[model samples]
Every structure is written in structure tokens, then in C-alpha cells.
Target: MQAEPCDQEEPPSVLWGLDPIFSAHARLYVRDILQMKESCQVPGIYFYRFHPIFTVDVLGTVVYRRERDDFFCYGVDDGTGVINCLCWKDEQWKQQNEHVKSAPRSLASSHGGFNPVEQLKKLQQAQRSRSQLEIGDVLRVRGPVQTSVQGQREIMASTYYKVEDPVMAVQISWMLELPQLYRKFYDRCFQMQESDLTDSAQSAPALLGRASGLLKDFLREKAVERFRPYDLLQKLVPLIPDIPPEPSTQQEPTPQSSSKQLHQLLRETLQLLQDEGLVFRKVISQDPVYQVTELDKELHRVTRDIIREDSKREKYAEKGCHVLHVLSAVRQRYCPNVSKVVIEVVLKILECNSEIISTTDSHYIVL
Candidate 1:
């Protein structure tokens, strides 16, 4: 499917907002996974989002009881693709135990000759109080999103609510359906291609039918788009610096400038360590190599001072550089995440300052 426009600023605040909400205004760090939602927001006026990827943990009410007494869940979209209600009635957190799914062992389980209207009133009241929240209100939620054959798209939410309206569950339910609706388009694409790929139209349907039922089942099970991933973006959005705490007179760094800073810091730290005898530079493969030996000597050094300044006290005297040791340790942990191509690109940028390293050599520029 072709990439479509992502509003980036949709309601329920799908857009990841600035960190640290100021005053009383709401701020967000939304995700589509219930597990992430719980980890993110603090207790206050906050929003949560997730999809059906986690149906077992979220709490919601029994919104619609079908003729067979099956329940349908509903809740707020709350971004992060999480719908706090109308989730987990059919599939999410499947009720494997027959006895558990039978009913709660409460008074509602017993069919007394009670008035239907009175029972409804009590149910609504309990929902409002966030007690026995079966069919309305709001909830604190977390988890992933996905669809079920038995239910419309649902969220595996953390919190449930019994609020003032019946329309919300239905409305949020529609919002949660976006991913599945998109998936449907993919299925349509596959279907349209199937018959054309085979010479025998009779065998074509059967051949294409070989696609895994289990895959389909898993996709449905994980059908809700509860998470915000770059994969969902149709095109590359302009890269902006991460939001900083409060505001400052100085402008923030752009991506290009930030990358340049990293290059400069690496070169400077390397030079400092080399001068301090922390790094024994060797020529290997026609490039500088380094070894770290003094890192063990400064285990007790104050980290902040070693990084930028030196201490004057006799007991806390300045020590040899151990930044190379740090560089080595960092290389061990994170070298795999970065591409060699990126390293080469950065080295080329550094090569642009060739007067300091190689006044006569142009061959070193190719890195």
C-alpha cells in the first residue's frame, strides 16, 4: 500500500508532545503498547493509549452482551492506539478457564427476581464510582492494539472507567479500527493478485489459500495499532532536536550541527587522552589506533571533574585521562547499533579539517 498522510497532530493527541507538562495543561508521551503507557505517565490528569497487543491486563466494562452472551468492549482512543474500554471481551486476555469466564461470583451472578431497571441503575452507579466498571466511564490504560474476529478493534487497557456517556465506547471503537481497515486493503491487494498469478483459475484459489491461517490469526490478534513507530509515517518528517527542558535564549542544535558536535567531541577527547598518556596511539591499517591503560588508575576520580575540569585539593588532585577507556567500553557496547558507513561519513567530515592532520596528503580524504 502507498504511504498516506499522517496528520501528525490528531486528536487524543497522537502526536508525541513536549515533555514535562507546564502549568496544568496536558502533555503527552503516548505509545500504542499498554506496557509502555503504564511506564510513561504519572498519577494525575493524564492520557494513555495502547492497542489489543495486550488484552489480558486492561480493565473495561461489558458494553454489549450479544444473544450468546458474548461481550464487546469499548474505550477512549487516548492516542497510542489504546482504547481503554470495549477491549478484551472476546479475545484479548482470553478467558481460558471456563469457570472464570462463567461470571463474577458476585450478587450479579445470582438470578434473583430483581427489577431490570433497578439492576441497570445499580450497574450505572457502580460504573460511575469506578467500581464494577462494566460499561461506561473512563479508565487509566496501557497495552497494544489489534482486532479480533469477535470484537471490533480493542485495546488491552490498564484502567477502566464508568463515565457519563454511551456514545464514547462506540466512537473510540471506530478510531481504533484504522489499522485493521488498512490491513484490509492489503488483504484485498493479495486477493486481487492471486488469480492472475496462476494459469488455472480453478487451482488459483486453492494455491493462494496456502497462506497461513495462523499468520492471519496472529495479525488479527495483534491487529490494533497501539504503538507509534516511525514505520507508520508515510515519509520522513523534518528532523528536529529533542525538546529541551523549559525555554532558553540560545537556539537548539539541528541534526547536522549535532552530528558535527559529536565529531568534534570525539576528536577532542581522543587528543586529550593521547596527550595525557591514556591512549597509546599506533598506526594500524594506515590510520591511528588507540589503547587504554590509565582507566584502571582513575576509578576513584570524580566523574564530573574529570569530564570538564580538574580538582585542586591534594587528595582530589588532577589525574591522567581515562576517556579512552570510556571510548573502549562504549565501542564494546554500542558499535553494533551504528553502521560502518555512518562512521566513514563522519570521518570524511573530520577529514575536511585536513590542515591539522595531513597538510600534504589528499589520499586520506576518501575514508
Candidate 2:
């Protein structure tokens, strides 16, 4: 977001665009829900507190699900802002509950959080198909108040999108929507075979990406998020540890034990990363030497971008993040001699040689 100089008596330039609406912090995005603790008080950044948005996964059957509140949609009207229209596809869940398990107010928060009145009204709505509920149909809903688009107020959809079946929709929201981004990130860890480290172009931001953003957020979150193949790839690339260009070694060499180890570890960690699902942007290719394939190089680029992106976030700040972290960790876990090369490659990530950094790609940011 760009801001121009203001006239006399005007506010600082920080008050413009998404900067004011989203502060950076290690965070995990599950489905549409974003989970993160405020890392710093960035001026003009929105939401000092962490808020979760639960999309209406199964609205058709559950629209009839009412809450303690009498209103059909949980009656939250934020003055003139957007309203969230939520539908619950309750038919399946209602049946899924053990016969002994009567419909509790809100899933686990048995005490309150879920209003029976609201659930009841939603049930009626489901019966009426008022919020556009249909079996095997998906609906895009907004949040903050229950009857979002239903109301005349302007509302941004924190929860919007459609899925085919209720079960699939729930899976999409719980695992695919927001969390899948990191899976693609983890997948990039293996962009090259376990043998591509000898290739010069394979290196990307090899360390910083491993240390920040969504990956970190995933490691820190209490819940597991989903993975979407495409979005995950797009978002994950930026969070990897892409490095600056290394002097070309035209004749590629064979992989060493250290190189193999790096690939093996990277592959394993990446798989674990998929399991971890949601995470911050901090990333590093624990074994850069083994991932020199063309695919690995792209992974490297993404890692660098995400690392930089996380740093620019209000919470990250540009300090105490470097290749040393990954190398040290690698050394502690396995080989000492190999980490030296890794250390060198890592240095390349931050070495701002615009002359060496590729200008071929439009997406790459040359610093």
C-alpha cells in the first residue's frame, strides 16, 4: 500500500491501506479463520485482539439451527459496516452426534458462546432455505453479525465461498481454505529431488523463510488447518528461503552425504510441515545443496519473498533473523562440515547483488 505526503495538519502516512487493517504476527489461517496473537502495537494496524471467523460450513440443513438469540441470523449489526450471513448445514452434524449426545448449545463451549435461540432460528431458516441453503450446495457468507447480506448494511465477507456437500464443505473450511497454503509451502521444500543441491540456481532464500510467518503461526497454533493445492502453492512460495544468485558451477557435481542428508531432512520436515498445516512465513531449505532442480529454485524464490514479506509485517521487524539460525540448527542435528557450505549459500540469500540477482522474473523483488 502506498501513501503520499499529507498536507499540513494531516496524519502520518501509516494510516493508509491494509497496513492499518492487518498487522503482522506469526499466524495460522484455518479455513477462513485467522489465528494469531498481536506481536506489536503497529500504529493504524487493525484489530489489537485476535478474532476467529467461523464460516457457515453446512448452511442448508443447519440454517434451521437456531441460537439462544431469537433472531434468525445472530443479530449483530455493525453500524454501517458489512454483515456476515451464516448458514449451518446441520442435517449431517445433527445425525453425526451420538444418539446420547443431544445438540449442545455451541459445540464444546457447552455453557454459552452458542445461543440456542440463534440456532433454532437458523434451523427455521434452513427449513425455509432463506439464506440460499440447498443440499449439496455451497454458500458464501460474511461475518461479525448473523444476518449480514440479509440486512441492508454494508459488510465485507470474512466467510465467503461455496462447497458441494456439507461434509466436504466442513472439510474445506476446517482444512482446505486457509491452512492449505502452508502445505504447498512444505511441498516446495521438495521442489528438487534429493539430489539437486549441486546446481547453483537451486538456492533461494534458504534460511529466513524457515524462520518466520505462516509456518511459524502453524507451529504455534492449537488447531490444525486445511490445505488448498493452488492457493497453498502461490502463498507458500513467498514464504520460502530464496537466496541471491550463486556463481554458476556449470558442471554439476554429485551429491555428498551432507547433501543427501539435507534432502532427506528437508523432505521429512516438509511432510511434517504439511501435517502442521498452518504456519508463519518463516522458512529455510534445511538442505539447499540437494535441491538444485528447476523446481527447487522456484521454491527458493518463494521462500525469500515470504521471508521478506514477514519481515515487513509490523510484528517481524528486520532483526535477529538470518541464515545462521538454520545452519546452526542443521549442525546441531547432523553434519558439521556440510553446514559450512549451507552457511555460505545462506549468506548469498541476503547478499544484495542486484548485478547477480536475476532480473528475468517480474515477480522477483531486487533489493
Candidate 3:
């Protein structure tokens, strides 16, 4: 009997570098760090879903410690899991340690009414002591992640320091902020354009672009404001080319395969439309219905009016109206189904037309 060949997974595209998050220091839990899948093509790089993470920021208590001549190794736990961190000793601190040892402490104090040099040395020593953490001290580490010889993931510390969090305020803030990051970024899949695919000429992306164009034209011609997936699937089926039977095996494309291809094309096309701000889903449910954004003039009107009215209020007099406040007002007045992303798209259009100005990243004011 012959053995069956296993299907190989495709390597991640180099175009992943174009994504801003791919280069940023991703704040992740120790457990997720340990669980991340390392890229097969690139060593030391790991992926959490579609997001590529090379460097990370972590906060935890030092549960174990080992001292070395040039570096310190620590086991840090942040209520998730423990990971080893290698922190190198600073050369300046090493020189300071030698100077303090060689110089006599009493010699400075004997003449010290107020010696500047002695005070400076004392301050340096205090800082050095703080940097060298004890086993129980809370530590914040930022560095690129790597795998050790024994195949365990570890961080090669670029920057590590002791965090003094009294009354647990820092920890509480971190706990609150991390979930928002996950919700807004980490959990979302990084979308890849059709041009990024391996076969550009006959790839899924080329098909997706064609399908998206067809759907947009259909929406415009029919004046469609709302649509469901099934409503458009029939129109897209003709785009999927029929496969001929193989010469040797005489294998033809199955009905299931054709249906799957049509569905996949529609799915990608819808996602592309959503990204371009042409359409958005009012609700997330088993049966998703899309609203054509361009057809909704009231959405744009309500969003702009809300910003204009709210910007003059005392609450927003300093920074103008915040994006969140605009979202809330638009949802209440215009349409309850309006999303943050749709609101953001509307804001960008209004800004481009010189109807409004961005006071801050999240605040807007009428022109």
C-alpha cells in the first residue's frame, strides 16, 4: 500500500511587513506568548492569528531569579504563565559598582558637609539597586522574543525595569487596557489584499475584485440599500469558471466544490466592500445583512450634525466632540445599527471635504 501525502501549509507573505502592527511591540499575556505559533520560514518571529509579533511588552512579578556576571535571568509570572527573561547588566552600572567598592565611604563623609560627587554617587547606586530586581519585585520587560536551545520561548530583554505599583493601581490599569487592545486589534484578523496572493493573475483576489465590482454595480443600478448574502450569491455563480474532466482520472468539479467557490468569492467580495467603506453590517448574527453605506445620506448628515452640535457644548469646548460621543449620538438619532467603523469612514469623508477638522486623534470639530 502507498502512503498518502499530507497537505503543506503556505508560508506567510513578506508583505506582512507593510502592516504597522507587525513592527510594533505587542502587549500580550505570558500564556498567549507561550502558546503563539512560531513562523516556520522565519526564526524568532511568531504569529497570534494573522498578526506578526516579534517584540512584546509584559508586566509580572519575578518569581525566580538567577544572577550572572554579565546578565540576570528571571522567571516572571503575570497570573497567566511563567516565562524566562534575560536582562543584561548596564556597563555604566558595572563601572559604578567598581567605583563604590574601591573608594572609601568614610573618606567622602569625613569631609561631607554637602559633597556633590558623593550625593551623585549615592543617587547612581540607588538607581542601580532599583534596576537589579529581587525575586518578589514586580518587573516590566520589553524585548524581542526568541526560542532557547532547549526549545522554550524567552525574551531577550532590550529594556527591563522594576515597576513600583503601590495600591495595585498600575496593575488595575493594565488589566483594563489589555482587553481593549484585544478587542480592537489582537483578536481581529489582519486582512490580506488580492494582490498579496501567490498567483496574482488567476488568484482568488482577482476573482474577488471582479465579484466586488459586479456587486457594487448591481447595488447602484438597483438602488439597493440593504442586502443579504443569498440575494447576491446567484448573480456571482456565473463568474466561477467550470472545470473540465481530467484526461486520466476523468474527474469533474463536484456541485459542492462549485457552491463552495461561489460562497468564498461572495465572502471575500463583501469583506473587500466593507473595508472600502462601501457597505457595513447593521448587526452581527447567524444571518448577516449588509447596508450600502453610499446609499445612506442620512447617516452622513446625522454624523456631521452631531459633531457640529456637540462641539459647541461646554463638555467638548476644549477638544471638540470625541469620536465615541459622535458614535453614540448618531446611533440614537440616525440609525441604531450604525457602527464605529462606519462613523470613522464618514468622519474621514467630512474632513476631506473641509466640512470638519480633527482636533485630536479621536476628536472632531466643524469647520
Candidate 4:
């Protein structure tokens, strides 16, 4: 007898071994992910800008619901839209959540629920132990973009994290991401000549050379602890003997011969000094002020006293003493004359040199 062909078919094999240049997933809003289109050439994968490696991140709230013994689903809404995410059970996850899954399912009854109070407590406790998350908690998810045969989109999550500040998280996400987008869009939109861009960069360095010496002399005057740009400009212009005189006639003035032009030059010079670590700028009441970075000179003169006081107290062996202790000791013994700003700058330099260590939110430690 002739054999009939079997109707049963094997499951489709996934492309599991496709490696990417960057293992790091891209941070994307839920709207961006949902809007992606499938690549014409690749099956079961989504693409953005025609690139197949479209892994992404989404931060949102998820509502938890138990789907099976080995699975659960979360309906995540990230302001833009909602997505149904499926989290599969790994061996470790299954082991950790065994107690919750092993609970009797007979407790779920049709009429008046059986053991509803007891079941609710067990589920809540299980959720805490398993995901350490509750329904409606804001979370950050990282995963590959997946599109099913029926046009439904989803993310196969690789990592999940609880977000503490959603606003800060969104702001930080755009802060990091917008630069790349700006470059892509602006470069295409305004195609400037390479020579023009290069010339613009070179002009600033030339200005820096002319103004560097004058800036050093102005700072040396010690007229104030810090100077706002306008106040500093008032005192600084006279010191620059080479500053071009204002145009006398109605004739158009050369670029080098205007005080208005010098305004921009002075601003760029201060920025250069800041970049070179020769000065520090801080904003006060919406205005930025510049301070010379010369605390090391004073610190060098009193280094012996600092070490001696630290040794007497055995502070070197423990977490370092606070800046206040060293400041107080230095003033009492050697230099009775010093500013608080000078002392703080010296401590900051020591921290940078690894002579001491300070945590993001804590006191310094001796190293």
C-alpha cells in the first residue's frame, strides 16, 4: 500500500546565534518600539533605519498576572502605549518561585471563592520573593525587538530594573540619546563645508593664545574671590594693552578692532581657562562666576603642617579626616590666614590624586 504524506510539521527554528557589534541595547521609548516596521528580508525581526539589530529598552509600569506554572505576563504602559510582555521561567527563577507555583490551584473556585484571603496573601508574598515588584511599579526593561507572523510586536526581555525617579530617568535617557539624533539630522540637513568647520575651531585657539597671559595677570590682581563675566571684563580690558581701539569713523571696522568683538573673545578665553583646569566656574542666581584654580600653591606651602597634624591624630590609617579638621589645623599652626574656598579646593585636588577618596554621597577616606 502507498503511504500518505505526514501532515505534522516541525516547529520553526530561531536564529539564535546572530551576534551584534554592540551587545549594549539601545534605549528607546515604548512609542518608538511600537512604531518599528519589520525588515522585508528577515523573518520574525523588526528594524529601524533598515538595520536588523533593533534591540531596545523601555521604561514603564507593569501589571502582574500569573499565566502558568512556569510563566507570567505583565501589561506595561510607558505613557506612549501599552505592551503585553511575557517573562519565561529560567531554572533559577522556577526554583526561587517554587513555593508560589506549588500552591493548590483548587483554591480558585467559581462561586464564592475558596481560600481567597489566604491565596491573596500567598500570591503577594510570592510576588515579593520572585520579582521583588508589585503591580503598577515603574520599571526599565531591556530586550530584543520581536514581531510575530500575525503583525503583533513584543520584546523578549533580557533585563529588568525598578526605576526610582521616572522623571530623571526620562530626562537622562534623552540627554544621552539626543546628541546622536542631532548629529544625524543636522549633518544631513545643513551640509556645511569641512573647511568652514575646521576654520571655526582654529579661530578659538588663536584667540586663546592672545588672551591667556592677560587672563593670568587679571587673576593675579586678587581683587575678588570670584568675578562675574561683566565685572571681570570691566577690570580686564585695561590690562590688555593690545585691545584694539573702537572705530572712530562710520566706516565698517575690522574684526580685530572692536570692543564688542572682544566681548566674545573674552568669553571664549574664560571657557578655555576652564577647560585647561586653570579656573573653575560656578553659577549663582542665574549668573556664572569664574574663580582662579591656584589652591595648590597655598596647599604646597602648608603640606608639612597638614601631614604632621594628620599623623598626630593617626588619621592616615583610618578613613581620612574631614576637610574642616585639616583646615582648622593649618590655620591654627602655620597659616592663620586662608580662605575656606582655598582649603576646599586643596581637598578636591587631593581626592583627584587618590591621596584621599570620597564617595558620591559620603565623607572622604584616606588612601
The global C-alpha lDDT for each of the candidates, from Candidate 1 onward, is 0.33, 0.33, 0.79, 0.54
* Candidate 3 pairs with clashing backbones: none
- Highest TM-score: give the candidate number: 3
Q: RMSD in angstroms, all models?
A: 24.1, 21.6, 13.2, 21.7
Clashes of each: 29, 86, 0, 1
| Residue 77 local lDDT, model 2 | 21
Candidate 4 lDDT over residue span 1-367, tens digit each: 8954321111111221122312437555566568765544455455432223456767677766446665556667765577766565555644545655676667566436677546666766565454544686766677777866675677766776556664676646754564465234311212223233333323443334435545655565564556777865654454233553443567664456546656876787676566555566533357776655564444544643464447446644455455676667766755554445556656656654556555321245555
By TM-score: ranked, best first: 3, 4, 2, 1
Off by over 4 Å in 2: 1-34, 42-139, 142-180, 185-367
Q: Give the candidate number with the greatest lDDT.
A: 3
**CA shift of 315, model 1, Å:** 71
Which regions of candidate 1 deviate over 4 angstroms? 1-69, 79-137, 142-154, 163-367
Report the C-alpha displacement of residue 324, candidate 4, in angstroms: 64
> Relative to the unseen true structure, what is the Cα RMSD of model 2?
21.6
**Rank by lDDT, descending?**
3, 4, 2, 1
Give per-residue CA lDDT, model 3, range 1-367, as digits (tens): 7943321221244655755678898999998999888876676788774577899999999999999999999999987789999999888876776776787656766775766457778899678877799988999999999999998999999999998888888888987788779756775544445455455324554466457767877887799999999999877765665533222355644577877887888888898778767798877799999988867777778888898888889999889998889989988887777777878878877885688998877899998
Regarding lDDT, does 1 or 4 come out ahead? 4
Error of 4 at 274 (Å): 43
Which ten-residue region of model 1 has the weakest summed lDDT? 232-241
The TM-score measured for candidate 2 stands at 0.22
What TM-score fits each model?
A: 0.20, 0.22, 0.54, 0.33
